[model samples]
Target: MPALPTVRRLSLAGLALATTVAGVSMTASAKPPEPAELSAAAQVNRTIQGMSLEEKVGQLFVLFAYGPDAHQPDARNTTLYGVASPAEVVAKYKPGGWIYFDGRGNVQNPTQVATLSNQLQQAAIGTGLHVPLLIATDQEQGVVTRIGPPATQFGGSMALGAARSTADARTAAAITGRELKALGIRQDYAPDADVNINALNPVIGTRSYSSDPKLVSEMTAAQVQGFQRDAGITATAKHFPGHGDTVDDSHTALPTINHTLEQWNAIDAPPFKAAIKAGIDSIMTAHIVVPALDPSGDPATLSKPILTGVLRKQLGFRGVIVTDGLEMAAVRQEYGDAEAAVRAIEAGVDQLLLPPAPAVQFNAVLDAVRSGRISERRIDESLLRILLLKLKNGVFFEPYVDTAKAAEIGPAASLATAQKIVDKSITLIKDDTKTLPLSNTPRKILVTGWGVSTTQNLANSLAKRGAVTTVAQTGAAPSDAAIAGSVAKAADNDVTVLLTRKAWDSKVTDKLGKQRKLVNDLLATGKPVIVVAVQDPYDIAYYPAAPTFLATYGYAAVSMESLAKALYGEIKPTGKLPVDIPVAGEPQKPLYSFGHGMSW
Candidate 1:
């Protein structure tokens, strides 16, 4: 028989027919089935048939740990705040999944994380569903990783891509997965497949692999495979369609990508398509607007044309589809929370990620279903997918991690692996005229900008080789006083190294106007200012006159250490620009271009 029409599109009589059909199947089943004998789909269907409207609705919404009111104790008797107790909300709502955030005053430790995961799973089973709940963390690596303390910190996606081969990418992902799995995290929302088209993109700069879709695809697939294979963890290829080309941050507001569908297919979609084909378990939708794909101008999270039409129909993705945090400004500032949840689900998102409030959002989904705005069958479709994930991961049979075995894996092994990948992936973009390898003799060196202080534990690795003097730059205003002081000190020494952080892109070009003027002033003083962009490659566009320029593509400690070593000739500048740096007035293209690093 043909499937009944969706509830929203169906009349009351149609609903009656659909309900009757569903009831008949349940009534026909006489005996209780064994857990091992039940297929994941059957288990999900049976469970869904038993849930109340409220419980079914609760399964669709994932609450944010850092959102306001998230700390309040849930009526379900689950703990709600801090990394040590993340499962409290999950236990309370029997939520389909958990979305992690770096809490304000909570420190994340392995014991705490393991405890939380255990509790979440215990809670899911307590619901009598006998299914494991999804435990997700934003371990995007580089700037967005949530696991801190003893966990190894590698440079983000950009630095990993800067490695000479895709093997390094795989190794990095393996390390990420090992640590996350050790902590009992089953899902990693990572392997950002966004093509870094706009240098000004604030969030994606270091998080993206490279501007080249082919390279990103290769590296993304490698990382996904590594995460799945090494850790037995499900990996999510994220910000689907793509978020790399946009100039705005979705957390603040919605940014529009002007590319037509054809352009998107050629440049932005390859990495995602590649990852999906490689069996990536999930894909997270972006909140940005792609007018060509969805002329409605709504963010992709709530756009049916983009989610169902393009991603599902054209791309043939059968895995779960998760939305970026619904509390982000893109959704909350406009549609409000309840409307956003409805639209996201109606648009085909299986999970409403990081909802502002789990209970309120859960109630809203139920209201939508009861009002016939969203069909209960639609809810079942998503629940079945979630259950399938749990089954595939063996969550039903073996839900808890062996804490004793976890202790054996230890943080030391993972840290060593992370350090190795970080060391290998460091790229030295430029050391022109043999200007690097500074004399060991004490020299007056000036270091300033984004990551100058070695006091930060994260900054210690980058300051090992230099006699560093930290200087600060005021917005759009050159530091004449500091620059003059540094120049005078350099005149008294054999060599003067002026270190400054580079700008990420054009949208924030004016923010670095002061630093640009400082570089020019240092150059005029006849001093070779080796400007190392300790962030993204976009910084090169602002300082064309610097005699020696280097791009490290990240701000991670190891990346900083690599930059410092490359500066004084202790190590050769062997890293290449992973993306093109466009010239001034010539389309503002990249300077050294992707794969153009120099080796001594």
Candidate 2:
């Protein structure tokens, strides 16, 4: 939102070089050295060589945005949004790139995505800079996926982690990477390395892998390898130092992590460190406060002690450091416009994501450099990293698909992969008394709870597997109809399968007191009450009364399909619970711990 500082002075040679590099022809008689006409490496070298202190500092600032507005006839939204197009931000922004929160138009298939990305890269190349942009998205899978539809949708980080096998995790990542690459997306802001430490953490619930750092580390590595090494997309390990423990959402405000530095190092930092060691290209900073790490009490985005001292110096992460989002409450509410950008850069962050207005922010960064608020050398450091990543990703040299070809790919691969993972990851936790493997005979079954039936068609696949009567509920609260239906179904049905889909969120905990009462009441009927959790395994704590309990970790269509198959004995329940579902409020911890599952 602030203007960049003006260039104080450039040597005659530097001006000539910049002009020449910009492709402005000079007279033969007065030809300055064509330093800019050199190769990409040469241009970078020349730019670094010719830069006035101010020009170099401006390079570190990266603006964030959604897709370019297709509504504008002139297509002038590029400058306004900080990206010429959604894809160009990643291809041209290079080491510093845009973090996309939302996009214009539809992103339902891989082909459209690929075409959009190809166009984006073309714009970057046309800019005359060899460096590729670092395009990023928050594709955590399950509840969060930027490229949905035709793309296969894995349940979530936890669902993948529940599979426990690194192979499974890697396969999921590889699938994600392949789909992303097909669509022209190069950066995946995923494999959320956060361990879900608190049940009340309103944002990171299903997004996180597990509360166990070791499991999170393994899954993070697998995902990184799958996206970067296998699929040729850069993977970012995010919300560092870890955001799983916080009860607040950074999008609205800063959350505090009260753990001591020792605790964080032991519990939270391992997954991030593992991701970095696994050659992850970037690490996204969380807008959270770790009072133990930064006693001054600033969010990690602005905390030098955390960003530079801990993540850089101690952890030795040499990759690009990205801020979560500049417009987030933690940043916007705390610092003024120019100051936020300056502090983040000085704090060692390589990119500023989703700034309010990119062009304005870019100008402000330029101004900051001129004013000596941000050092030119600091800018060079980030720019170099970005260029290096572009080189590594082969963006400068590789040929990408055009828009037409991209449209043809669709999202079939993604959907198929999602279906596979869901089929493999759904586990039957306990089927005591052998209530599962339901009879093929027609029988009325009551399916009640949140996410049971939605416009998304989550329950459609399940209904095809057996005779199912569906009832929709909302939130953590169980509906009266759902409760009454469960009771009524138990009274007359040959079998009663009370499928409770808990809506996943940071604010909701495992102990569903009201829902538990309903399950207990259904259990009182002395009929087979099979409680299926189409969300987190933690919900099992609420329905201990049920003879059979299942954890699917998601309510996506694929998950529902897989759950249906498992119920009919079409597939074995070999998947494990990825996180510890603590018992009620006792905090006995581990009603069913990580890696615990039962075979059919």
Candidate 2 residues 101-131, lDDT tens each? Answer: 4454435355545555555555544544433
- Where is model 1 more than 4 Å wrong at Cα? 1-45, 66-88, 103-106, 127-130, 357-360, 402-413, 439-445, 452-512, 524-527, 568-571, 584-590
- The alpha-carbon lDDT assigned to residue 393 of candidate 2 equals 58
TM-score of each: 0.83, 0.82
Question: Candidate 1 residues 174-198, lDDT tens each?
Answer: 8778777776677899999998977
Worst 10 residues of 1 by lDDT: 1-10
Give candidate 2 regions above 4 Å deviation. Answer: 1-40, 47-96, 99-108, 125-132, 357-360, 408-418, 452-458, 466-528, 588-590
lDDT of 2 at 350: 82
Clashes of 2: 31
